[model samples]
Target: MSTAASEPEETTVKQADQTETPLESLASICTVLAIGLFVMTFIFQNYKIPSGSMEKTLLIGDHVLVDRTSFAPPTKWAPFVHYRDIHRGDVIVFYKPNPETPDLFLVKRAIGIPGDRIHLVNGIVYLNGVAQNEPQAGKPVEDGNPQHAFDAYRDDFPSVPPPPYEIQPLGITASWALDLPNHIQNGDLVVPPGMVFAMGDNRTESEDGRYWGFVPRQNIVGRPLFVYWSFETSADQMSKTSLGDRLSFIGHILVHFFDETRWRRTFHIIR
Candidate 1:
């Protein structure tokens, strides 16, 4: 009688330890996925560096994760979260602030904030009458190399009025060309309220604020936090928009993923 009683208790324990049913497992997976989707949609987002505008700092194919909460407006729901206004020198991702490219997003470093006076001399940024020491900023070497030769209009900035759009080598938009003059005061470009002056680290290659216009505060997105992954990619690869080209690139990535990946840049923090 005692042995039989013990056997029934062992059977009960085994039944209780049985694995979850298929439906239960599926539900668990869905719950996890929903949480992950929420986090990615609201808290963090990822962006890829498609151009060399921010070269040396952010290379082409560098995939970075951006924190969306830092520069976002305060909300009572998440009062505990820390939020702050964008500061000078912060790398920002924002809409191009151009009617022609309304949907385009560009990444650049904030050089001027509201009320700040800005100018450039020989490609060096002069913020509020003092030359900023920006070690990351890149300019073409003055070795008479025509391809990398300096441009007086780009290097000198507002000091040299942008040439007519028809003959302009620099990518200065016509609207910006007209509006840029209104902001200049005593040779300094005064940033108006709710506007930011931004430029790429690679000054020679970037078509940034000098080319377009001030980034509206409303158009400002969050700053990048770190490079999650990077792979060797061509500068013009992003221009190929065909379905076949995208699929071909996907195949190439799969084949060369291990070898082509920039392992050193993985998880590299963005300043």
Candidate 2:
């Protein structure tokens, strides 16, 4: 009788070890998913390229994973965490202040830091009184007139745009441009403390520091880690306002995902 009872007890123990309760299984799944979501929303973020503002380097429909921890200073309790400085030429994502939009995030290259003298001569960027060697400046955009081709407000930094077209400066840039003369020293714009001068890799097409003024240190987001996905969709498709257009774009993506996807760009590291 004792031996028979022990056999049944052993069988029950094995059964309990082999099968998980429904609640236990669900809890495990929830834990895994919660961790994944936390990592996605906090440590890294997914960003879609809406325009060619960062062309060549970051094209339209290119999805990037921005690393949030790189620029985050370590806490005293979390001193073991890896942290690095935001160096020049780093591609960073940040919140650019815009009254129209609530959360306007933009990606650009960091050109100058606090105390760095930044200026542009005929569109070539000079940092600390020296010309920057940026091979990724992209192709020059053609703006109709050959004479004024290199005379946009972007081309001649630290100086107001030539007469007649001088009224183009807007908002914060306009305010900064008004006081730009005070900051200019020997033709270079000295970056104020706690601010950074940022621009886009596609210099000709980018509406960056040249138009907007310096980016504050607090506005600096983390760097772009890699291009996770790249699609051939146009910029217009990104803002599919109508329901039909949105559904159609979704169907198109599902049908032509392989053909329209840029396979080479997937997992490409951003410099």
Q: Which of the numbered candidates is closest to the native, going by highest lDDT?
A: 1
Candidate 2 lDDT over residue span 17-102, tens digit each = 98988999999999999999988876899998887778778999999999988787677865767888778888989888444553
Clashes of 1: 0
lDDT of each: 0.91, 0.79
Error of 2 at 246 (Å): 2.4
User: What is the TM-score (0 to 1) of candidate 1?
Assistant: 0.93
RMSD (Cα, Å) for all candidates, in order, is 1.9, 3.1
Per-candidate TM vs. native? 0.93, 0.87
Q: Write the per-residue lDDT of candidate 1 for residues 61-108, one digit (tens) a residue.
A: 999998888998999999998999989999998888999889887889
Question: Which 10-residue window of candidate 2 scores lowest in summed lDDT?
Answer: 162-171
